[model samples]
Target: MNSDKVLDARGLACPMPIVKTKKAINELETGQVLEVHATDKGAKADLAAWSRSGGHELLESAEENDVFKFWIKKG
Candidate 1:
C-alpha cells in the first residue's frame, strides 16, 4: 500500500510503536496513509486496536522477515 509517510518503529516495544504511530498519523491529512514498520511482537494487535479506536482504517498488514508492516489510512 502507498503511504504518505513511513514510520520506522522497528525494535520499539508496545505503546512505543503505538505512540509513534499516533504521532506520525497526526501529521497526515485525512485519507492519507501511514506505513509502519515494527519489530514488536505485540505490535499487530496493539496497532489494530489503536487504529480501530482512533477511527483509522487498517488497510493492510503483513509479516516480512519477522518485521510487521501496516498500512493505515487516516480517517
Candidate 2:
C-alpha cells in the first residue's frame, strides 16, 4: 500500500517505536496508511498490539535484512 506518511523508527526500542507510530497514526485520516520502519525486534508485536487497541488495521508487516516494515491503516 502507498503510505500517506513514513515513520522511520529504525534503531528505536520497544514502546518508543509503538509510541511514535501511534502519534503518526493519530494525525492521519481514515483509510490512510502509515509506513513504519524499525530495527527493534519488539516493534512487530508492539505495533500489532497498538494497532488492535486503536482500532486500526495492520495491512502488512515484513522484514528486510534487519529492518522491519509495518503498513498500518488508520481507522
CA lDDT scores, all candidates in order: 0.96, 0.92
Which residue pairs does candidate 1 place in steric collision?
A: none
CA displacement after TM-score superposition, residue 68 of candidate 1 (Å): 0.1
Taking all chains together, the TM-score of candidate 1 against the true structure is 0.97
Best by TM-score: 1
lDDT of 1 by residue, 22-46 (tens): 9999999999999999999899998
TM-score for each predicted model, relative to the true structure: 0.97, 0.95
User: Tens digit of lDDT per residue, candidate 2, span 1-75?
Assistant: 689999999988888998899889889999999999999998889889888998999999999999999999999
